[model samples]
Target: MLAKIEELLEQAKLAIDSATSVEVLYEAKVKFLGKQGSFSHLLKEMGKLTPDDRKTIGKRANEVRDILEGKYAVRENLLKDQELNSQLEAQKIDVTLPGVAPERGVLHPLWRVTKEMCEIFSRLGFSVRTGPHIEKDFYNFDALNIPPDHASRDLQDTFYINDGVDRKPGDFSPWLLRTHTSPVQIRSMLTEKPPLRIVSPGGVYRSDSDMSHAPHFHQVEGLLIDQDVSMADLKGTLGFFAREFFGSEVEVRLRPSYFPFVEPGAELDASCPFCKSKGCGMCKGSGWIELGGCGMVHPLVFKQVEMEYPKWNGFAFGMGVDRMAVVKYGVSHIGLLTENDLRFLGQFRP
Candidate 1:
């Protein structure tokens, strides 16, 4: 029995030394120490020995088991260290690399121009006002004295939300994409009294797209109402706006034009900011560039608003914000404003 115990100890020591992984080391432990293993078989045979011999064999067996357990513990720790070393080597990261630079963003050119326009208008005592992109026919047309037979309606090239052709001009369909910000004018008059001076800057829709036009564009409409407002006051205000916006050297002029809401509407122009009245491709070889349209508030327009007709006189004007931006920046195509081309937009960054 002693010889057999010695042989088993040697075998266990060899197995623990040869073990390469924690799983193999655990299997080796089971082989030597389990209930049906060599140590247990030897103990079963010990009951036949004398008491003294039994005690001696028991001490030897305990010593052998302890030594084997210590060996397995060492092997387990060694295997764990090797596994940890392998993982650390595989996941190593370098600390000396330079960082990457992130890209910068900027505002759209259209918005920049819009801000510039609003700033100029604000400086001229015109408070900024806004209205819904959707509008009713009453405020957009009827309240502005623009009737079903108005000629200006033909020129607007409006895009309607409903079947406009199916309804009469004055029929006032439920709603439509506002053709101009001028609807805000009617809204302001309906809600506010005279002595209201404001400029409405917002998006408007039309059924046109070209190098010079976009299906949807921005419009800045100005309105000044008071008991003593005059066309001269309109010219003076626009003259200051043109000079401040274009340059202090630019001149303003009002040419006779017709609009349904104004008894005597006129197209306003400024000396070409690009060529200063000299022929240029930018101004289409014309000495002057038309800025917008303006007129004294017509009696009919006042009456439509139910605002003590003729008791309050004023002037209103509207201009395309896109055209203003193109002229100011010399942009070649109107479509470029909406294309989101980073290279083109980058030029307008502050």
Candidate 2:
């Protein structure tokens, strides 16, 4: 039995030394030390021996087990260290390699143009103002001198909230998405006194969409009120804006037009920057490009806001911000500004 135990220990030692991995070493340990193993089988046979012989064999067996356990532990740790080193060598990163760069984002062209226009106006002594996209009928129309029967009040032109279906016969004015930023001017006039110069830039909604128009668009409207404000001041300011925004060489002109909120309104035009006022396809063979509308404030508008008419005269001008972006960036369609295509928008990176 002693010779057999010694032979088994030698076999275990050889198995432990030959094992290439921890899994193989664990299998070797189970083979010798398990319940059905050689060591357990030898102990079972000792039941037939005398008590003194059984005690001596048990002592020898325990010493052998301890020695084998120590050997297995040392071999296991060495194998683990070698495996870790191999993995480290295989997975090491190259310090000389260039790091991957993350993609960057840019401002949308619409917002970029909006900020540029606002900054340009800010330099001209106009502070910025904004109003709610959802507005009351009074501020949008009535206070702006736009009569109830005006063409813009029709369902086809304006987007009325709740479709005006929940209104009673004599309730408050109907709510609607604002048609223009002019409502901001009205609200400003109600709370502020004359000598107010402001530019309102924000989104407006209409019940229309086409190549040139959209259901939702943006506008920048300017209002300047003081004693003795006139059409000449409006033209001069607009001309300076054209020169500064388009180019130092660009010129501005005003043609007779009509708007409800102004006593004398004119369509604002700029000499085609693309052709330097020479005929071109951009200006449709004409030397001018229609920019927007400008006018002297109507007396009826002042009456609605309770401001003395002639004592506090002013001029208001409004232009489509989308149109400005289109002209500035040479975009083919107004609808392109709203379409969230990355391919189209990626071109405007700063």
User: Top model by lDDT, which number?
Assistant: 2
55-109 in candidate 1: lDDT tens per residue? 9988998999899889888899999999899899999877787868687788787
Q: Count the backbone clashes (under 3 Å) in each candidate.
A: 0, 0
Q: Give the distance in Å from residue 200's predicted Cα in candidate 2 to where it truly belongs.
A: 0.9
Per-candidate Cα lDDT values, in order, are: 0.84, 0.89
Cα deviation of 278, candidate 1, in Å: 1.5
Give each model a TM-score: 0.70, 0.84
lDDT of 2 at 39: 80
The TM-score obtained by model 1 is 0.70
TM value for model 2:
0.84
Single out the weakest 10-residue window by summed lDDT for candidate 2.
Answer: 164-173
Off by over 4 Å in 1: 1-98, 151-156, 163-174
What is the RMSD of candidate 1? 5.1
